[model samples]
Target chain A: MSSSLAQQKADKVYRDFGLELEISNRTFFNDGIYSGQKNNYLSASIQPEYYLEWSGGEQSFKAVGFFRWDQHDNRRTHFDVRELYWQRVKGATEVSVGVKKVFWGKTESVHLVDIINQTDAVESFDGEQKLGEFMVHFSQFTKIGTFDVFVMPYFRKRVFPGREGRLRPGSEDGLVIDSRDFSFESNAEEWRPSLAFRWSHYVGVLDFGLSYFNGVGREPVINDLSTFNALYGTIQQAGLDAQLTTGAALWKVEAIYRQNEFQDILALAAGIEYTFGNVKNTGIDIGLLAEYLYDDRDNIALSGLQSDVFTGVRLAFNDTQDTQLLLGGIFDVERTTQLYFIEAERRIGSSFSGAVEARFFENVDPSEFTYVLRQDSFLQFSLTKYF
Target chain B: MKVLTITFVLLSAVVTFGAAQTPEEKGLNVAVKATKADEGFVSSVVDLKMILRNRQGQESERFLQNKTYELTEDGDKSMVVFNSPKDVKGTATLTYTHKIGSDDQWLYLPSIKRVKRISSSNKSGPFMGSEFAYEDLSSDEVEKYKYKYLQEISLNGDKVDIVEQYPVDPKSGYKKRIAHYNKDKGYRLEKVEFFDRKGEKLKTLTYSGYKQYLDKHWRADKFFMVNHQTGKETELFFNNYTFKTGLSEDDFNQNSLIRASR
Candidate 1:
């Protein structure tokens, strides 16, 4: 009995510490219309994590620290504790406390329902990067579905690019955003209490989630373009995200109804993806994607995807390197503006990987918000090493 | 005189039973016995390493951790967590293999902390660029196939039973599979040959290094699969298997997937 117990203890191995380093270089094809904008830029980021688990893996603590250095944008170069939390799981109940990031959407074209954490705008153009929010979360799993409840004590303000940043509103006629000059509709400001709930489950071929949030909005309302004045307001939002998986096709939809002090909005994004597997015995899979986005706010909406159509194609090489590529474009229905992009990535060796991305903006109308970025088409390359 | 009479009676009974059973019934009986040989293992966790080789002899390796929860009536629930090949590290996939219709699969991407429901229709495609298909690694339920017994033969000096299995699901990549079961042992699987949808020989998988766990379950520690048409190969090694680790249905859910991935 003693020998077997010792053998069991010897077989368990733990990976407690991890680190990742990423370096990127970007070049713009045409010089930006704004002054102080550089044609070339370099940036680097490091993320270190420490994780520990005990009680038969039912309880754990994790901490992740992130730091970035940018060559041009001072505001973009910053540090954050992406995730610092303690989690416990017992039976069908799970609880987590401290700062964490939560995602809640199904559509790929536009995330209309994912509003938990504030966007880290300077990190990437896709708005997928998020700043962690401090919260106490509880989850209960039942036969009907999974219920998630979140109590956020403090709100995270959205991080934007600095004056020297390429993607920000340009200084066409001395117009630049003063990110410091921001206000909240609530008296508590950044310390305002927030609450959110979500129920997600799968039934047969359909998977869906229904969520509601009452808190400070993740997206700030830009009051004036001249000074780029912004306001964070308390809002109530009800959202639904669903997906239907049928054969080689996936149908997705995300809709939300939100009420705020400024406006009441209804937005929807629906899309479908179909894949042709192993085309002609070449071991390559190609998927076609198309989505339609609509918002009642129309052109004034902060998201440029309003009243637009997005189309894309994805290719999976199914090779040993795990190579993949995506080519996509977003076309504005009311205006002549069009945005095109291509992204490709492949594993280099055991621990390193590389990616390439390029974006183009064409036929931008002056009335549109993205007019300042007309000459900001750029290509970027990034290498990441994981340890 | 009494012992000789009893032996004669037992021989006649055995011959009569063999003559009464049809090839299909015998085949199903053997398949059921092989599956039952590894039953009663409530839950298990094992580490797996997959090595992929191309026609040019270039090789790449992937490491993963797999956990399984055995359900009494329904199909098993399993999760595969990627640990190495750094880019895909912290990614995991959860699968619920049903006895009928289609299986449900979900993928958790750690980079974004998102859980996505993936279509299981592409059963024929390679898994992680390996020779094994998604269907090949799915839970083996008797309802998924129809079996017919072939002639018994000696394989490497061991008596073996060969059975032809026809897939029930139309989306399955294979039309039929020929499985070799060792008769001298506890009806353990020794090898299998897969035929593609076009009725062409596609791949061959061989298993070895059988070890009994919990005294009742048989598991193979090594698996080697070779694709005939593509000239590609994949080898899998399973290590440090622990059974009955007190895993329940909760461990196989999407919530657990996200937690385990982190």
Candidate 2:
């Protein structure tokens, strides 16, 4: 045994821990807010994570806890255990069982292939944050690729902010619907079974994934359309995502096919990002991205990305502060609706950073998912500190 | 008798040419010999602390761990994982340095949950707002520079060889760089002075307290850089170097970048 490595291996406490706290305050861009809540409200969150690795390197455990308190919306005030899992790796195979979050696909604007974890929509409309799921997974790595199989025994439903939340955008008649009123196709509710299989590989400059999942739909279908009450249905989905790099540009594509008792649908997102490094020979680098989103359901889709084009630009300062800016817009080609968004962040010092996000909607069609929230355009600012 | 005279003149000419080597040839010979002393190390792992000083003399510190997998040909792959400065902790940068062309770089942001490919053309830009530019920490290779021997001199009571070199890449911000190596210490690198594109002195880098490992490789324990233009400085302290721990190519690929950050 190498003496230096052996000495390091003697320490059984290969562990790490961290805590993060964030607060966000938002204000509306329009004075015609229908919810009757105060223009500005406060939302705060605390997250703590812990990790441990055995000296033998055969087993490891990780846990992350999250809690949030909101002044405006009761539903927005919640708690979640994002991860608490034990994983073991032996030879070319690995297995893990616990509450965990698994992310898949390679698209920026939409994630059609990621279905294992429930979306924490209240955290951010982007669906980047997810609530962990209880599951048992087995993965094998081979010369050709990695194959993973997951069986999730418990399911978590999606979250929406309270009635007083800015994005709540009350129904057509400004009626606030409580989440408790929603019904499920199966009385089992959280005990529904979910199965997923994914195969991912890299060949030269191309990276790709093929995945299939069968489970209760992540989004609820509106039943008794006038009441805004919904029912959760079961469905099966198959997806393919790929990306290729050539020079300073990356080409990406994501496609999915889903089926349920009511209908079968197809969705796709394709885009390209080209980087122009150091504009004017300066420290800033910019990337131009454009993508088209299409869904067979047209305006009936909930996410509202159907038959629309998304264009965005990302700027990176490459400074010690790690400053960045991203601005994007989704424009409907068949209608006169558009959604514009911008996010900027920069480090205040070594341990603290600040961010601002603004979202706007114009000429939203009533048939679109976000139409009710048309007048909810608002700006948000947050500060995050790590220790 | 005619053939003998012709042979004699040819032999004399060959001897004269061999004695007077061109400056370029001599520089290349020195670099080759210096690089040859560090062969067969395979791979190495290290942890380092970087100290940044601004013009006003204020200072800050950052800690990082790094692993390098050296390929037999082409370039070496290296990944650096940040450990301190809570906001940037868990951030990582992966680089594939090629001797013949610009390097490929990727930055993994824990907040964004994505690995972004960054521009390598701005290598002259300051590294994390420090005196050391991105190009300064480049993986040293013989083919990356064109060298010319300046002279042999005595400095700091030691015999040293001075050489001037220009970067092979056109996007390089420096017009040229001058390096000094101690002749008595097996051509060990000791110092370097950088000149900007306008041919003005920009920065000076010094290394000392080298510790040898694996019986053949030498690594400096302390490295410092001073920016002449901005009166800024940065210091690097290297510790716990381990060589040949069986790191493979698979560990240096894009897929491993996520693992490296954790």
Candidate 3:
């Protein structure tokens, strides 16, 4: 036998343990009247993972768990549990079950933060909450390509009590109906399945996926057509999601057209991000994102009220071993406003780092539609410790 | 009967004299033979733990690591991982051999969120502040060196064969290397002398503490190398050596390097 083959046989005879953790502090600033008072926050999170593989075997198992606590200005402490899951592998097939962050999209930097649901602190949909669902997923690799599919049976229920705080559109108080809330007659009501397809070639890769459900997206409610017709109808129309990545750029576009019960709406979104430079390290990344959301139930033009067109440019420097600086600005074409952010990070050692960031929100309305509506200025500094 | 006895004695003397060849020739033959025999060992995926000693010759730091190495016909490619000191753990370093030229390299820092391809062309550069240079730690196949028999030597009371080898790669920072090989242990290399680009002795690498595993393979548990001029020393401890893992080329690709721990 070859020496490498012998080495492979030897690797199957031993096992080891590994662990990692990260702690970070984040603060938010909203100077607009809608944002309430300037709030400072500190949060510490711990994520632990373990891997086990039997000797002289191809089977392996991995488990991960996370816990976090955040302290706000009101002395209120919020605790969060993130990423609890177990994965098993046998040959070319891998399976994962439980609550885990599922990432979709090929964009270098995802811009439609609202469309995607997962746990992230950097760019959450305004007033959006982390959503988790109990799911089981299977993936297989073959010479032809790689294929993956996920089945989520239950959904997370999110209810926002009326509060005086910064609120984005589509985040208003509402009672959502889904598997967690209501019982329906169809099997679709029992479980929602998301399908993803990926094809990789020597030159590039392409990925696409679609999620179909009763529309509550994990919200629970009684499926009474009469009482909850408006919301129930939207849940019936499966949404279309897809992403494409090739060469130096990646793009993702998604649309949802629902006409089920009481909900009648059409929403379309598109985002394109391009990376330029040698190996995409020290270069410019620019993205264009636009969304059109229409609500016909109320006979109101929600599209014009919620529609937004944004263009952003990011300049990355010193992206190698020592230091990194990122300067970027987002222009809101519909709102006639601009937001600029700058972040700089330096490595102190292998496990420790410090960063400072500043952000400014400005009104650039040449039309001068309304000066009072103009929003401006926010800044924050943070330090992170990775274990 | 007396004449037959004399002929047998002459034949035995000739055989004994041939076995007494210089250690240099034996060491060179062993080095060449070992590489030729292991040609099919193309790639290796392993978990490594290294203990770095301070200037006082005392263990000062420990690094837990894992990596997948691709030993190609051209050169060695590896995805190095650091899982400690929180900031650097998830980072991966990718080293690839240039198809028609020298080894090309790059590092992907997750914290910085960028892939920085190495631009430096120096092979003798220090590797991550260690005593070993980038060239020395690389996978240098037997074909890269031309060998000549040197002399016989005794180390720690064990007779060893010594040989000198000159690197064929123009980018190599060494004039030649002198190595000592043990005759009984599959002729495994025991020590090596590295010469500077200017043809001067630069460093010495010693392999000790041999252990047999699976009744078929012999491994050196401890490897210590000292810089001749700088007086700096580095020691590598191989606690686990596995074989026949059945890893494929797909497991050592670029995406695997990035999403390794995940």
Candidate 4:
């Protein structure tokens, strides 16, 4: 099968094929301030993407695969498929079924209520956090507004044993709550769907949109039926999302104020960005973003009932020399701890880019916390080359 | 002494005649008149195709299309259709402009199966990531810019006239602009140099391949602009020049922007 596939690809390449690859080295240095040990961590990732367009744009297919290896304090290696999807669009409707980046928000950095793709840093800490999911989406154009809806039947589940222990599937060492862990197998019959509406008027200037999605939050796991019934008394089953964009600013806010099923989450985010140039000119641009998340849950273990506030600013500078610079920072404020991060990126050329980032975290009462240390700082450097 | 007095009066009359028509005033009048005439001619519906090229003269993208434009004395309407690049096929954009206030716009994307309404204040932003802002594509009527005749200049070996224009929009990114127009082509603009708010040269737009359509109407087939600081360039090619489609204000309505096609 591999040889036949290779032969067909070779034949297609002779006709017309495009191939792109990216390799990067990422390293993180920590003074062991929080971990109580200095650590140097290195990770390398290789991503190869292939595009094949056949017969005058009739049938085209694109496939992208990613592989990564991490060398940390403990030698553990893992690799996963990032994106593998095929798309076919006939006229006003298009369909894609596979693992893909299902973006569903209008904000720049923070998606106030978007639940499609799991976030990066938040997902990285947990092995069960998967970015893409298996789903089928359909989009249609209309005179009043455009409509987009997707059906996700399978969800990636995170199996967390407890707050201090590692997450392992089918483990009973610690108390397990379904509200914190996402399981696709438990609710396989339940289908999650999302809808988006867009409307525009005037010299292509003004645009507005509203979106809706079902609950994609983690389901609660109740060992006893009475406990499940008690928790189920006050769960709201639906989530609400909406966004608006004018020429000057793009704004979006989302909230998941569901009462019962187990997770009570309310997240709100707003972002504003402005571009100065025409489609042809590469010039200076500025963007400002701010986001806040409030999660209220009873009987859940991780971070026990927490509210996080995030604010960030991004500045982009692009010149005709194929040189670009992006400088930004994000400040995360919680009740007991405050985290600040600043990052800058410079594009050397079309195929290469580098970035440096610094992160600092401070705990107010360090002496009271025994499990996790406070006052930590980490620096990271990365160089990426795109083929 | 009587002859000298008569000669001085005659000389003074000649000087006053010339002074009555200063070069700056004449240039402003010509610029305004040309803009008004152009706007009047392009007020109705027109079918156009644009070809974009890069600085290296390679065709970066080609838009094979037809567009319907409806304009009023104080407002304008436009609907654009994309016929190339199968990924963006069946995409239609509808825009409405108000003379005294902000305009409203909408875009229908086939892939997303949704129509998105765009806000007006973003008119100064680049269209589709191009250097041309949404306002740049609107009708360039006399009122859009305040004019000042700079000087007489020569372009493309033709003796031309130059005028400066400052955008009336308070939020405009450009401080001022210099335009070179062809005298014989109904004062049609040949090129323009845009200056930043700091009064430094930012970009230059050149119009070429001027074709005379409908005898009295002159149109440029190619519009190219280059950003001096950034090497990026954008070119627009106009083709299938069809005029007078008998379209009325009703045709430029929101419903028509999504459904109408030439």
C-alpha lDDT of candidate 1 relative to the true structure: 0.88
Q: Write the per-residue lDDT of candidate 1 for residues B1-262, one digit (tens) a residue.
A: 9999999999877886867777888889888988787788999999999999989999999999999999858899999999889889889999998988788999999988899999888887889989998888988988889999997999888899999999998878888999999987778889999999899999999998999888777789999999999899999999999998767899989889998887
lDDT (Cα, tens digit) per residue for candidate 2, span A1-387: 577766665555678899999998988777545545557768899999888878545577889899988887777799999989998766567788999777777778888777788888778778888887899988877788889899998777777777677676466467765556666776787677889999987764677889998888787766544567677778899999888766667888999999887668899999998877655535677889999999887644567877899999999886667799999999998887899999999988788889999999999987787776788788999999898
**Interface RMSD (C-alpha) of each candidate?**
2.1, 3.3, 9.0, 10.2
What docking grade does candidate 2 earn?
A: acceptable
Alpha carbon lDDT at B88, candidate 4: 37
Native-referenced DockQ of model 2: 0.30
Q: In order, what DockQ does each candidate have?
A: 0.50, 0.30, 0.09, 0.13
In the range A1-387, model 4's lDDT, one tens digit per residue, is: 356644553355212222233333333343432222334556666655555554322235555555555454222233445556665544444566777554444444444434555433221331223445566656555555556666666544432222321111111232323433233322432354332232322223334445554544433334342222212122233344455555556555555544434444554554455544323233455555565545454224233224556566555443322233444433334445565567776655334566676655555333222113232356667776644
Clashes of each: 0, 0, 36, 50
Model 1 lDDT tens row, A3-66: 6754664455455888999999999998877788888999999999988886666688889889
Please report how far candidate 3 places residue A49 from its true position, in Å.
4.9
TM-score of 4: 0.61
Best by lDDT: 1
Each prediction's whole-model lDDT (CA): 0.88, 0.80, 0.50, 0.51
Order of quality (DockQ): 1, 2, 4, 3
Record all residue pairs in model 2 with backbone atoms less than 3 Å apart, i.e. clashing: none
Best by DockQ: 1
Candidate 3 lDDT, tens digit per residue, A1-387?
677756665476333444444345544454434433334545565555555554334444545554555453221122334445556655566677776554432223222212223333222222233544456767666665555566655544343211222111111133321222344433564344433333322212344445443334332222333233222112544455554544334465656555444445566566665544322211222333333332233222211223444345544332222355666554544565565667677655555577766656566453322222234344445555554
True contacts kept of 1: 0.73
